[model samples]
Target: MLMLRRTKNFLNAHGVEYEKEHVNPLMVPERVYVLKFGKRDGEFLNRFIVEHSYTWTGRDKINKITLRLHGQKHPREFANEAKLLQYLEKHADRYVKKQGNKKAGKNS
Candidate 1:
């Protein structure tokens, strides 16, 4: 896996906007089998929904989760994250508006 700094640099170079979600390195599973057997995938997916879904209001408009499984060959998790990102990117306008509405409601 690549170092976090390297990942950040790569994303920056590619013009990808991202937020880093700090996590406990020791708690992160290094293998796909462990993630699947330990039920981390389910938890991650749920967290992803909560973070990305524009159902909540406030300053937390975008919820970016940075995983430490950099070199891990977890194709499933990667695919899931990619799918979510694609969905968000495809309907970015709607999602942004939804987030705006959420903030407006909070302000009022």
Candidate 2:
């Protein structure tokens, strides 16, 4: 109770709530969603085991298909181009940061 009282007294004395509330200026996108897919295990090289089962696809379709057909046969490893830059460049203006008065979460 003493700590809470002290904090309240300090806030009241400082009057920070009225001291020019800083508006977080940002371009709030209309839609927000998570982009999840299989990431390469190698840090130096974004490599993944790709076989005939794992084919390149748009919008992470390949990853989904690989998940479905995984471990059925021997897979051949190859470099996957699922990097953030390539994805963003491919689909421009699709996602944007949602700035609001909310607590940060995972990947936020």
Clashes of each: 1, 0
**How much is 36 displaced in model 2, in angstroms?**
6.0
**C-alpha RMSD of candidate 2:** 23.6
Q: Candidate 1 lDDT, tens digit per residue, 7-90?
A: 345335544444334233355333121111112323322122122313335222333433333234442233334544555456
Candidate 1 TM-score versus the reference: 0.24
Residue 59 in model 2: lDDT: 26
Candidate 1 lDDT score at position 55: 36
Query: Evaluated with TM-score, which candidate comes out highest?
Result: 1
Q: What are the lDDT figures for the candidates, one per model?
A: 0.33, 0.27
Candidate 2 residue lDDT tens string, 6-59: 322333443312111112225631111111222234211111222212124512
CA deviation > 4 Å runs, candidate 1: 1-18, 31-82, 97-108
- Ten-residue stretch with the least lDDT total in model 2: 60-69
Residue pairs whose backbone atoms clash in candidate 2: none
Per-model TM-score, in order, reads 0.24, 0.16
